[model samples]
Target chain A: MISVSKLLCGLAAAGDGLRYDDPSGPDQITEQRQRKPVVVWNTTKGCNLYCEHCYAGAETEPATGELSTAEGKRLINELAAFGVPVVLFSGGEPLVRDDVTELVGHAADRGIRPVLSTNGTLLTRERARDLRDAGLAYAGVSVDGLPETNDAFRGEEGAFDAAVDGIEACLDAGLKTGLRYTVTERTVDDMPGVIDLLHDVGVDRFCFYHLDYGGRGAAVQDADLTPAARRRVVRRLCDLTREYHADGAEIETLLVGNYADAAFLVEYAREELGATAARRVYEYLRRNGGDPAGERVADIDYRGDVHLTQFWQGYALSNVRDRPFGRIWTDTANPLLSRLRTREDHLSGKCADCCYRDVCRGGSPLRALAVHGDPFAPDPQCYLTDAERQRDVPPADGNGVSEPAD
Target chain B: MADMRERTRVERSSGDGREWETFVRQDPDSSLRHVGSVTAGSEGVAYEQAATLFGDAADIWLCPAEDMCRYAERPLCDRIEDAADA
Candidate 1:
């Protein structure tokens, strides 16, 4: 995830230190994050709504052999033991499970900060209060677009209203809540409306997710914005974020699922905001260590499979049911997992030669897999041009002038 | 709690008699639309029911009813039953 607010606007988002190793961020969180990754546990595969781009291909009933309450608690124990700093309780919809609060409390008790990712239609006032009381740190509610568009995308007529209700419930119950929007050709136009509507409703954070090709999402791969369109959307998001900050709105905006935003931000800064800003953005992206799939982020599916990422459920390192998650993650003996950890060494084609490879690590390997049938292939979604991907000669001094060759 | 490494495998049952909400696409060009739902013991049964019910459709999708939690005003099960009645 790229914090547009932090990079362009110089805002210190709550987890900036831990996420980007920003010196201005909290030292304690950064120290803990260095030791362990953030885990997204797909608590169940059951969901009320069938979103067009659902990565999990979520259904209404929990998948056969979903981790039981006891099993979930054990997983929490394993994560706590592994020193995982955060556990995002995600699912078809986490609220579907009766034991969600208990699980959250268990994670909190074990020193793991438990957060949530849900559709938000079910987050009633009582449910939000229960979750807060159980120690949920944050709740990210997915709201793809405006009522009509979001309803069309989510396969529910009143989903938008219900989700808004859910968000208000979370805010009323004193839980930190945010909006999660997946950018697609169909939904991109509704972004301004979503932001304005949710912002008016008191939501301070908005996470815009790039559509990744996985699960049902693969069916709509064509719906992903064109390269030029994507760049325009991102630039608009940056401008909107700046506007919010300028207005003292204190709104936090983040872009997720695409690390190209890292390099794009630097370039955007250089061309628009100037050299010093570009340098600062570059330094932060460097600290972030590029696409964090196999390193900073880990996914445990409903059943016990550990994926390099939530979107890359196509591959699994091992099952936590058979081995401890810590042991599985650290094994690295799995060739795919090993390669993903050091993708800089394995990246092929345009990605291998791209100047910003260090900052993007070839973008999302899952997208590459979807397009090229090879995880090491160049990310088809990398919108950077040939000139932009070239490494430039370093400037001799602090000024933007390049030094002559020796 | 048992140590992760030392824990014994527990017997688990398959999702049987579960309600699966069905979706259908009229043709290749159309998006999947929510149809009615069917009660089945497994994915195979669910698929069979969906294909039989929405036979003319080009594609079919099913999600479990238990997974969808919604507000009391419009429960997913209630909607499914209404669709079934329709």
Candidate 2:
């Protein structure tokens, strides 16, 4: 999660310790505290709508061999024991399962913050109320574009209306709601309108997810944003975020699925806000570690299989069914899982040589694997120029500040 | 308690200038409190605008600005004094 809001607004919400008054000075100041990664639990492999870019390849029917409600509750308990701070209930469509509220309630009871990620088709007013009553902290609803485009992408006729209604229902029910827009070349042009629509409808948070090549997404990998296009899009998003923020709007903007966003933001700040602000941005990026996939992020599908990320399928370090989730998560014995822990030593090619390797961390290893067939290869989505990559990154020399970007 | 902090809330005004009253709560069990208002063209749009305009509250409520009712023309404190005098 590249917090566009934090980077743009300089607000310290979570994980970031930088004070607004006295920002961290140049020498690489590392945040000493390490909290458990937010874990994603796919509550069910059942979905009502068949989205074109469904990462789970979800169909209209439920998948065979999902974890039972009892097993899910046990898994939640194990995750809480593992020190996971937040558990995000994801899909197929999390709302498809009848006992989702019960599962969320159980997780919350265990003191783990529970969040809901859904397609928004089934989130009725009553259901949203029940979820709030059950202790759901936040709910993210996915929307690709306006009614026609969104409905088309969802592969349903009434999906757009239902989802918009769902957003209203969640708000009416008092459920803190957000919008997730998966950015594709097709939908990129619609971003401006999407932003306006979200503001008009009163959705506070908007996440722009760069296309990750996985499952159905692989079919349209060629349609992914070009480096130049991505830069333009990022600039637009940054401008909009700043505009809204300056006006005192509570709306937050975030970019996901791309670590390059951090580097981009750093460059943007240096160009616009000057050296001191840029240095603060760098500190925040370094503290957060641009990409947290293998190190901090972990996901479990409905079938109990664990992967580095929700988009990463086919590779499973272990399953919760075979052993407890805590054990599986900490067990670095698996070759891939072990390699992911110390990726710096194993990052191949340009990624290893890049000066900003610490910030990019070879970009998304999953994207690298998807396009290059090697998990350690440089991320195909890396948008930095050769000049930018080759620039000597000055070490944090005490409280020293580096020269401003030319 | 009423928020007395010096803060500037960015309001999303629908071009039409009509607005809706908005309310929010910290959690399910908490009572709803009026956060602010959102300018929107219609009630549906008002709900959306209100939802986005409010800060990180757990729940939100929106109704047309015109629909709200009032008990008296003066302040509650002033009303209590008048009733005692009467």
Candidate 3:
């Protein structure tokens, strides 16, 4: 996840230090998070609503062989032992599982911060309270667009209302909650309205996810925004984030699933904010160590299979049931996992030649694989033009000024 | 007695019987009640069974049958009676 607000606007969010590696970052929590990868655990595969872009291909019926409560607790113990900072309890919809709070509590008890990613339709007042009491740090409720658009995307007519109620429930229960919006061509127009509606409802954080081709997401690949459209949307989000901050709202806006945003932010800053601001953004992006996947992020599916990232579920390194998660993660016997660790060395085509390769890290390998059938192929989703990408840019100096290239 | 013991051993190892017992509560105010049992090769399978059968339940708990220790001298008892009495 790229913190557009932090990189471009210099906003200091609670977790900004984790991504930007800010030297004077406020707390020990940020330092702790910097050392560990955030783990996304798909607790269950059962969901009430079948979303159009469901990455897990979630269904109403539970998939066979979901990790039991005992297994889940054990997994949490292993993650904590491995020094994982955060565990995002996600799923087709996490609330569909009866042990949602129990798992969240287990993660917390083991000293790992627990967060939730859910459709929110099932997040009733009681449920929200239970999750908060169980030590849930935050809950990101998916809201694709405004009522009709979101309802259509979710494949349920009343889902929009239910989800809003769910968000309200989380807010009333005193649980820190935010909106998770997947940016797609079909729903881009509603972004502003959704933000306005939810912001009024007390949600201050908005995560805009680029559509990654995976699971049901692959089916709607065509619905992904065009390069131009994506640029416009990202610019709008950056503008909105700055506007919100200027108004003293401190709204946190993040872009997820695309490293292109890193380069885009730098360019945007240079063109709009000035060269010094651009250099600062570039330095922050470099510190972020781009395209986290096999480095700073991991996913453990319902059956305990660990993947490089949540969206790269097509491949699995090892199962927690078969071996400890940390052991599996460190094994690196799997060539793909090993290669992903230093992916810049193996990046191909435009990604290899691009001046921003150090910052963008070839964008999303999963998207490249889905589109080009090559993990190392240049990211088809990189919106930066040939001239922009090929520019002989200088590295940022210690003083946030660009040093001449050798 | 020997036959019963042998049968129990076979059942535990065969992986065909309902080795996992599941419980569920309808809501926070409700008491957890034993819903059913499922045959599973691993903890993940057992969870899927419980979740699928009681997806709408407010809470669900699963336990391996072998992990359960009865207080009485029941057929499934695996612990010493004195341990419970103490």
Q: Tens-digit lDDT track for model 1 on A1-406?
A: 7778878776234444324543222111463475578898999999999998998879988887688777777778778878898888998898899999999998998888888999999999999999999988889999999999999999999999999999999999988899899999999999999999999999998999999987788899989999899999999998899898889987878889888888888777777666655666777777777777788888988876677788866445655665678988887644455677888988889888888887889998888877876677888888998887884622112444322222
Lowest lDDT 10-mer window, candidate 1 chain B?
B73-82
TM-score of the second chain in each model?
Answer: 0.60, 0.56, 0.59
Q: Which is superior by DockQ, 1 or 3?
A: 1
- Best-to-worst order by DockQ is 1, 3, 2
DockQ of 2: 0.01
Q: Where does candidate 2 clash, by residue pair?
A: A174-B59, A201-B48, A201-B49, A202-B48, A202-B49, A202-B51, A202-B52
Give one digit per residue, the lDDT tens place, for model 2 in A296-341. Answer: 6778887776767887654455456555667677776444556677
Model 1, residue A400: displacement in angstroms? 11
Pick by TM-score: 2 or 3, better one: 3
**Winning model by TM-score:** 1
DockQ of each: 0.05, 0.01, 0.02
- State the lDDT at B43 in candidate 3: 82
- Badly placed stretches (over 4 Å) of model 3 are A11-32, A392-406, B1-86
Rank by TM-score, highest first. 1, 3, 2
lDDT of each: 0.77, 0.72, 0.76
Docking class of 1: incorrect
